[model samples]
Target: MLNDLGGQGAISRAADFIVIGAGTVGLPISVLLARKTGATVICLETGGLRQEEDTHPLNEVVQQGMFYKGASHGRFRCLGGTSMRWGGALIPFQNSDLCNAHWPISLDELTPFIDDVERLFSLEPGPYSDVSFPFELGGTHVNRLAKWPEFRKRNVAALLDADVAAAANLQVWLNAHVVKIKTQTEGVRLEAVSPNGDRLAISGRKLIVAAGAIETTRLALLIDRQNNGAVSALTSALGHNFTDHISAEVAEIVASETALLNKIVGFRFGAAGSMRNIRFELAPQAEARRHLPPGFCHIGFEVEKPGGFDVLREIFRNVQRRKSPPPRVIFDLIANTPWLARAMWWRLVNKRLLFPAHSRLIVHAVVEQLPSPNNRITLSDTCCDRFGLPLAEINWRLSKEDKENVIETSELFRRTWRTSKFASLGVWKSIEPQQIWANIDNAEGIFHPTGSTRMGACPADGVVDKNLNLFGVANVQLLATSVLPTGGGANPTMMLLLLGMRCVNQHAAGSTPPKA
Candidate 1:
């Protein structure tokens, strides 16, 4: 059951498994271990049960190198973690991504866990790679599809609330911030503090750190320093190879054949209540031939009518947040009555999210960052958070090759559009590569921070091994986007969840928890 750390009295100080950061990765793994293994699992969350504006301060970091906006605005510390603010986009890693020699495990090794991930998310069992473009785009680009869960199911805490409550062996402690980790040869102990200055020490046979990428790396760096590298000699690579997806709006398209364009680029609702959207990317052959990093282009729409359905959405969000709509918001909603009515009819009756009539189409391109050691996260000597812990100092930047990947991918799409039948019916507002690259500052790092504390085959290259166990610490494992060796063009949340499940399952099978 969920309990606030401050209110819980005489709680168990030891458990079979201890998970830090009761967020997207932590919560599911905790429930799985409790239900499947019937072992006592305790989860510690840094934030309260609900999302709040005041919690934003806990996620703030100092920028030392390249400025990353996600360091300040992209993360959440609430119960559901960043999934509380997620858009529900589920994109799996491509086969090529797993077999790229960067990852220690291959596609076949990871395939067995995909169905489990789908089941956890309440999605239909199917292959994400099966969806492709009906027509080829000169064999240079391939099509990938991203599935979305229903709006109500987006927040993982809400999705798993019933299961969490039903799990008798699971205990979730909210407002329990882990400030330090103490490791021993046999196990690990976590020192957590509550908002009211109540301190709790929890010990377990095994500990999993599922904090988000940046925070996870920060904690690892701290542990390494505290232990004087006894934790892992590979701690040298702990903060290296930081990566995130780079995206920007590259062009505009005005299509006369709106139906055809919609069929190709519009959102498709599945019979099982999932929404799917297609993105175009470099094919494996083209990627190898060109020696370019992974990248993709997708279509976005700008509402033609003023305020359109967006105003209505804003009002709904405001109500959900328990805030009163401002006068301008109310006025916009009233002025867009006709558009709202049509949008509502399309949504409720047709089961489709409709773009306003005559919506202007925009082309956006995203590229996977080539992992670079220069982009990293380190501890700040000068700054500390409320808990007196060093704030994370992020040094992130896009290399010239990263910028070129975006330019080339965007240009490929522009060229494909020029040769396609839609070209005859539409006008394409294409931008030069130089112009697109110049404006790239507007879309740096789309909040998918990854590759810090990446996995490797040995301690020489990575902080963690294939099983996500820290190089020298056997009882402590890490399950976060930070452990991902490579960040593909797809979203990393689903992949991280899959890896988390695999880590727990492997740990459960390998040995029993030490006697408590």
Candidate 2:
């Protein structure tokens, strides 16, 4: 792949619109903007065109990249962004999640966005089957159970195989790390640097901070700190609220010898065998509910769907940072079980006196956590990246709301599994006396963080308005997954993509370089 500069000019030319990131939201949004108005779109990417095919020592334990058994690297640092690692399965936020009161905007507002993402990605119907998957479980697990060769085709993208940094109208800077975003009342000026001493600055009619959640808010905060006392336009909201989906999976289930369970799961939502198949559900216990009260959040389990990863294995090889050990003993682990697991869930994966199967399944769940001051992102005096930008210091904290979500969701999972009719397949079998589960204390993240530089009623309460334009920063809009006012219970990709497209359409109408 040729490492080409996105635009012809080394530094002289400015663009109508500039988008940062280029992964999830960045990828689709840029495509949309360029397609709609033919704007001089310039996208900046820190990662080079080709991913390092070799593995370093990154682990999944702390949001680092991973290669599942030498497949494509888990996180693509290139043009596709993380979407390259996307499983392509699309699902919307739950109905209960639609009216998130804490959110400045509701799910109804995002409904159109969801539809747009589905259509744009060519999302297959299997993942969104109207009829419940043929399994006894509810409609939630459709992405897991049923699978064959077809499922891999859902949610198509054009990011791969293209000279990621080259485009007809899209000027992409491959190694450009946009470190300083100079916001002026006239327009926004961008300063991007490459490791080899390439420095470029150009103004835009509009700016979309398409960097991922962490990176986007990090830059915004730096802009704030840089102009802290210059009567700058940035409000106190640049990097205030930062939160990600906290998923807790405990290895607890013991299947019966006659369980007849596929090592993982086989899902076929409908005729589109490959389109949708993987599935699972959460059944919380009663005590779990008493511990955490619930109202408007989403809680559930994401069990592994049937089918081994042969098709995507090679795709992930280049981006994976770790070569994960082959998983043994397929057992069932509950999502949102971190608190209970830490308190009473099992973790010492090697104990044998009371162990059951060699293979195990994970129950991944995402519950709601309210935005709090403690969980804010801040700028650091040190820790700069390869670019001259300061690395962000994330002070992630678990609130009472997070704790409540876990407890209530865990209790609900216990109930659904043991009592529901769908639990017939050895799901509720009590283990032997010796093999007791242990409880966990805190739930960690799933990289689905959002709400930092949040959208709010005004500058006093939020960073950007509903349009995602920064409160006081003129001509600069943030487009990554960071603008969500209320964190949705579902994966952030679909909604983020929707918002990005919407913003792009708005910019294209009267697009130019941003006001300084």
Candidate 3:
């Protein structure tokens, strides 16, 4: 049942399991445990049951030591968590993803949870597991467009309108911000501020901090400070090695006929009820030859001038940045043009406006960021949010290896395009040799924050064990992209959900309550 935290003494005095943050990651764990294990689960959400006017303010964070401050805006502070803002894109981790050897747990460990993840997302499995796609590049092709179902309509609808009246063991407390977590010999005690501004303490036998990457790191830092070197494993790794998918539009691919493009990339509807846009990456063997990290590049098929859409995007961005209404000319253009008006309305209803189909391929590259100790999140020295807790300061930095990967990968794509029969030399224009990599201005982080509280077999390498349990804290666990040791080239939604399912299964299999 959902309980409003604004009322006096609304929180339950105790719970068997406490899950902080009722977003995509935390919600599944809470629901599954309550249903499968029949355990009393308490889910504490900093946001409300639905969207609110004040949602943006709750996400206020201090971004320091970074050129880009977009990370805070990437996170949504509502009941659905970031999933509220997610596009519902999902992709499985490729076998080559294991090449980095940064992932403490083998891919096999996560494989068992894939079926559960597919079921939860209403997907058909097996397509992603195919050893190779039908894209014909003579084993030299680096990319293919695969599809996955978008989850906003399917998953969010269930969570928002869920009738949990029959779930006696589950309680979801909304508008309750967990400020501090204290680990004790028996369990964990969470200090929270209710909507009514009252201090409340909630205790649980097992604590799981499923807050997103930034918040997860912040809480770890806070807990580390409280323990005073008792859990030094987290204290050392909690705020270090933060990373995201560094993306850029590096080049374009032109084909004489649309069907000819099929030979280069796979475009088929899978049994999963969604189209797969399997992306391109540096081949594993080629990657080893080039000494490059794993990364994926997405190519958008455009039927119209891509520049026109970009211009409109920049205009809207400027208007939003200025926080002012659009000029009268903007309204006049849309008002006079029926198609423009329809596009604007569609964009309002859906975050993604439907772009007119085109045969021209626009290549956008997203490279895996090499882990850097210096690129991290730390407790801000001066800034604090509305809560007394110190704000999180990000020090995101790119590496020399990252630049080399982009340049080399672009060259590989060009070489493949030149050799391929479908891509006519007349239709395709070669990227200037000097500008092998895309302009730095076009490169942006895909906002897949990961590796801050990474998992590893040893404490020296990471903050959590393969099971996602904190090295120093016995009863506390984590479920977020923050625990990912290596950020792959694909979007992280599916893999993260798989990780959550694994945690839930492990906890349920034990089915033992902490001794009182």
Query: How does each model score on lDDT?
Result: 0.78, 0.52, 0.68
Better of 1 and 3 by TM-score: 1
User: What are the clashing pairs of model 1?
Assistant: none
lDDT of 3 by residue, 1-516 (tens): 877677755444688899988887888788888887778898888877655342366566665554544465677666667665555567766666764655777778788887887677666666553355343544545553434543333344254346355677888877789887889879999878876785668888999999898888888788777766556744477778888887665676665654435433433444533445656666656644346666766566655643334445445433322223357546555543654665555445532343433335666657778888988888888888787778888887676678777766666666666666546522555556455444543444677888999988778888988888887876888888989887876787777888888888887888965335
**Better-scoring candidate (lDDT), 1 or 2:** 1
Model 2, stretches more than 4 Å misplaced? 1-10, 53-76, 125-130, 133-167, 227-234, 250-265, 269-274, 277-358, 399-401, 429-443, 508-516
State the lDDT of candidate 1 residue by residue for 334-428, as single tens digits. 78788788766765665566666657888998888888888888889999989999999888888888887788778888887788655865778
Q: Predictions ranked by lDDT, top down? A: 1, 3, 2
What is the per-residue lDDT of model 2 for residues 66-176, given as tens digits with 9 covering 90 to 100? 111211233455655665445554555544443434556665766666556655555443333325433443322222222222323321224323533345667766777
Relative to the true structure, candidate 3 has a C-alpha RMSD (angstroms) of 5.9
Q: Which candidate number maximizes lDDT?
A: 1
Instruction: Give the Å shift of residue 298 in candidate 2.
Output: 12
Consecutive 10-residue window with the lowest summed lDDT within model 1: 315-324
Q: Could you list the CA RMSD of all candidates, in the order they appear?
A: 3.0, 9.9, 5.9
Candidate 3 TM-score, true structure as reference: 0.83
